[model samples]
Target: MGMAAVIYMILSFYISNKRLRYYYRFVSLLAAYGLIMSGTRGAMIVPLGGVAMFILLNKNTRYIVGGAICLLFIYVFFAQTHILDSNRQIHRMRTAFHPEKDASYLVRKANQKRLAEYMVHKPFGEGVGLAGMEGRRFSRRFTTDIPTDSHYVNIWVQFGIVGLCLHIAILLFVIGYSAYLIMFRIQNRELKGMLIAMNCGLWGIMLSAYGNNFFWQYPTGYIVYIFQTFLVLGKSYDKELAEQTKLEPI
Candidate 1:
């Protein structure tokens, strides 16, 4: 995924090895080009959301202000002006800003509404496998009737409002705790920066899961889990880095 490549680029910037860092940067550029050619709107959120998180984590007044200006420019570019509409890729991305007019988005929303009404009675959901098409092999009930376009929506359909709330709470806790550690517990500047980059990448993927089903899917799942694990275990990393630093000659 381009998000992975972007994370690599960000991490590479913090690498002390100049030649290796440059090599990674070159590879990241090629990977970014591939991402652009793919025309995936969700992938676009990686840079947008990741940059926002990066700014927030930095807590630097000047960088924060600059990031805000950049975000505003992006909003104007994608949501307001038609300057880049001539480009096919940009046109497809702009549609994400106007979900109200997008037929596919409307259908997904309609499906959520339908599921909401059906879920009024089934607080615990129909069953486990009944969320998406996985239930087709298990049961043919009301839960299986509608297509759950997003991972969150799919869980809501399968587990009902209660399970949905629990799922979200766990996710919030993981993200919250990891962020706190990164802000205060980590000591190695290089390791901290790399971890921050990974956190931003994972954050973007988590946010995008609202409109996608890749949270638990292949490739992306491994990246997400590994990043979150590293973030949560940041204190352990800090301890090791501290020891390693102690052994180095001044």
Candidate 2:
């Protein structure tokens, strides 16, 4: 999956003028579909979030109307009809907001509370391995017997609030910097479209990380890091463009 994404990005760079726009859109849709099939509700957010960002940034009226219709159809088919199991969809929606009331939510809450209590005096955190070991040792501390694996909670427990804050700052910086580049520096439609998709993908994954700890773990983590690297690259591209524009005679 990661390799496919990289290939898609490289292709985006070399695509011809006529086909370039379609290529990025196709890749974005494919990525979104893959995330949805992953069956982790959190993972599904990536594509939808990316599409949302695309629509907002582009502001093309026809695309906006089309997106609205598609969203309506999705809500009807997935949320209204029982084809996708109305009850499960309802539960997922409810869990999105009041995760604390849901079983998994309660377990995470309990683990976080316990971890926070444990970290008060030890500001640097209990060290990385210690928290994982403690999760197993205090398996009984949570409502569920399963081990805690939430990235939000895990990072806090392992790095304390200080490390967590630094992590958050980096994310904020990426997001802000990406937006700045897209808005100000990128004028090429193909590159702009790719960056927009990347930005949305990052946002979706980051939002999903609130529930799962995929940000620094396997496949998803690696994908997110690569996407971030692309954002930085986009910024560099913008700088080059600015320099070129300056050299052109007005």
Name the top lDDT candidate.
1
lDDT of each: 0.80, 0.63
The segments of candidate 2 whose C-alpha lies over 4 angstroms from its true place after superposition are: 1-33, 64-83, 86-101, 133-146, 239-250
Separate clash counts for every candidate: 0, 1
Q: Which candidate leads the pack in TM-score? A: 1
| Candidate 2 positional error at 166, Å | 1.1
My TM-score estimates for the predictions, one after another, are: 0.91, 0.70
Q: What is candidate 1's CA lDDT for residue 98?
A: 82
Worst 10 residues of 2 by lDDT: 138-147
Model 2 lDDT tens row, 150-242: 666667666777887888899979977888888777877657767876776677667667767667777777778888999878967767877
Candidate 2 residue pairs in backbone clash: 151-213
